[model samples]
Target: MTARRRWSTEEILDAAAELLRTSDAESFSVRKLAAALGTDSSSLYRHFRSKTELLRAVADRILLAAMDSYRPEGDWKQRIMSLAQRVREAFGQQPQLAAVWGRHASSGTGSRLVMEEILQALRASGLPDEEIPTRYHRIAVLLAALIAAEAGVSAITPEEYEQGMELFRVAVLGADPGRFPALSHFARDVRPLGADRHAAFEEILATQLAHIETAMRSR
Candidate 1:
């Protein structure tokens, strides 16, 4: 009889992180994780109280890795943009995890690391210390939502995305020209030649920063 492999916390989390990258939501359970590590479910249970806790740990590891890989070497805006882009790209690579990233609880050690990185960039922007906290919170939330939308769609199978888009296009074409003229007119180009996601993100980020800086100047 084969003996079960003894899994370390790091080993388990490592496998869990990889599993999250390739597995679907339904296939991402503690039992599957343990099996992947050549251990039993009880072995995983010894470390994590539940599947949710286990997923949270895996998520933290992903975030931690993302933060560590970032090398800041630019202006304040560039550094801040790099931070957001790096995290987004990291999570984006593992579409499964990226899909549910924002739904999970924050304030973990990994999150603290990321937050500190962002605040550091903000400090370099020469913002008053008092306004940093509020700006940090707002920007963090906005960055998360933007990344989620960008990466979550990526996590799905191409077939699924194409199928959804097909439906969307059909609906757009079916819209009344009198009432939804704008949408109907642009139906062909909506998906066939859509705007670049990264460019769209840059536009949004620039607008938000412009508004925030204007408000700061007035106040």
Candidate 2:
């Protein structure tokens, strides 16, 4: 009889990512992953210490993919913006993974690479050495929080998401014009609530970048 092929680390991570894509991280387990791979759970344990370790590996894999295509050739602002977009796009692929990273602080190689890239960009911004760390922390946390928020939207059904947006629109538009004249007057501006969620994200990112730029220019 032919022997079954042993699963590689890459294959295991790929399977885990696929499972995460369909089901949430809460319900995912090493046993379930082993079943999907047609192998014993011990095979997976040989590669990873535990489920948390395995998931962190998966998150690193995704970050590696995000960095694979990243080119840090642009100026500081542009490079930082591009990196942010790449990170967002990577999480967009498997938003469920973002939630995992959200709950657990990521300390993987991929996460370190991202931090290094951000620090490089911040240095290029002409920020003082002492201030770089603080700025880096702010930028990193901002990106993580915003990306998690975006992923939260992806976690829900399209209909439910749109319904929530519509409800916000109604709440704003239905307000008494006399009491909330400014809000009511501008409700039409936000009429298309869910049409371009990324636009809002990009705008917020841009604003934060602009603030950093202003600080850099002042120094």
- Each candidate structure's TM-score, on Cα atoms with residue i matched to residue i, is 0.85, 0.84
Q: Model 2 misses residue 191 by how many Å?
A: 5.7
- Which lDDT tens digits does candidate 2 get at residues 7-70? 9999999999999998988999999999999988988999999999998888887788899967
Candidate number with greatest lDDT: 2
Residue pairs that clash (backbone atoms under 3 angstroms), model 1: none
Q: What would the per-residue lDDT of candidate 1 be over residues 97-141, giving only the tens digit for each residue? A: 764556664546888888888788889877899989999888878
Candidate 1 stretches with Cα past 4 Å from truth are 1-3, 25-27, 106-109, 185-195
